[model samples]
Target: MSDISSFGATAKGLAKNPIGIIALFIVLIYGFAALTLGFNPKLEFWERVPLVWFLVLFPVAVLALFGWLVSQHHEKLYAPSDFRTDDIFLKKSQISEKREADFQASNEELDRKILEIVNRLSKEQLEPEKIAKQVAKEVKDATTFIVDGRAFLGRPDAVFTYPIAAFETLGALTDEVYFKLSKSVRPFQYGTTWVLRNESTGDVIRTLRMLTATPPGQPLTDIRTLREVGIHPGNTLVVEPPPC
Candidate 1:
């Protein structure tokens, strides 16, 4: 999830306008000043220096200017406050996402162990269905199944993935899952449309144009209708213009 965009997303963010790009040269200016200082270690280096205080004060002034440039145009160049998805904060998102993925993987592994036990019991002339029902009583909080939604945005053609719970609906896919995917596309509900297509056949399975969050029983985003529309795992959702 942290690999949110292609290379140069940060560069593009800073390149929005001329004023925002001044910060890029800060390091170059400092590098040139250091080269100008020469490599002499003479004892009279301090006294013989021309305006020695410029060395001390100039760096502070340059850093302050850099901070000012970032602050002024941050709204246009940075992610929203909630996501903190600028390049600097992307590492935090990566760490958090790794932890969540590990936790979900652990949950799925536990479910697999239970199924293994059921298979072993069935071989012993015992009723597996009856025992499986008993086992299903536990760990029933909707974490047992996960669906991979390989999603791509139209304009940039950048591909990203979102995990869909087996029980999640179309409304939840956008309003909850995709919304948390990136702050750059926040508030994705307005006039937003999705095309769910078969990965092999390249056929359109479903189309959802959500005006509101998933309602309680709307057919548009219903997970229960997956069988009716031939939706399965690894289906792709293309934003806007669908696909060829």
Candidate 2:
């Protein structure tokens, strides 16, 4: 959820006329000065220096510095409040090349698996049922599964669950999951899911929100159907399930 209440109307009103808003603030400050100082034209330079330069400029400098500090500290926050993302590119790049190469190699393997699945389904003789059997069998044999490109998946014993199903029979992959919404589907509903997996381990590392709400009855099958609803098939939702 976003904090729209404080920002929406205020931003809207300010956006309508930026110059007018600035002018209004200036007028308020001028009015306050007139009431306090009352047109003192003949004051000495020392007195005028205190009033004009020290009092005004000192406060303005302090305010400018304060604003700069706040911006530096709060740069992570954006409009709509709750919407934020981590900027860790520099930090990631600082890691050793060996580690980066390893991650890339894993990603390539995940891609190979996705291509394999798609190619298998495209075969003329194979239908959804066969695909499900093959996929499940393959998953059972393999240590992990790649879902979309965001998450990595591998079966792990209980006590190692860092995320959803960490201890459950459901496997964990090595991909990083990201939560995002899709606008490609119609009649939007919540609980849409997407996954990202490491290319090598076929592990799901990332899970994202699909645009649609959960479908009643059984979970959806076929990546194309998820896309039809404006969600991506990816690796996780792309697989076929046993028929009801």
On TM-score, the candidate that comes out on top is: 1
Error of 2 at 170 (Å): 20
Ten-residue stretch with the least lDDT total in model 2 = 167-176
Cα shift from native, residue 146, model 1 (Å): 8.9
Candidate 1 weakest lDDT stretch, 10 residues: 141-150
Q: Put down candidate 2 lDDT per residue, 24-100, tens digits, no spaces.
A: 45545656665445477676777665456544665577577657756654432223222343433332233224334
Candidate no. 2 TM-score: 0.25
lDDT of 1 by residue, 113-173 (tens): 6677667667766776777675564344223322223344323435544433332334454
Clashes of each: 1, 48
lDDT of 1 at 236: 52
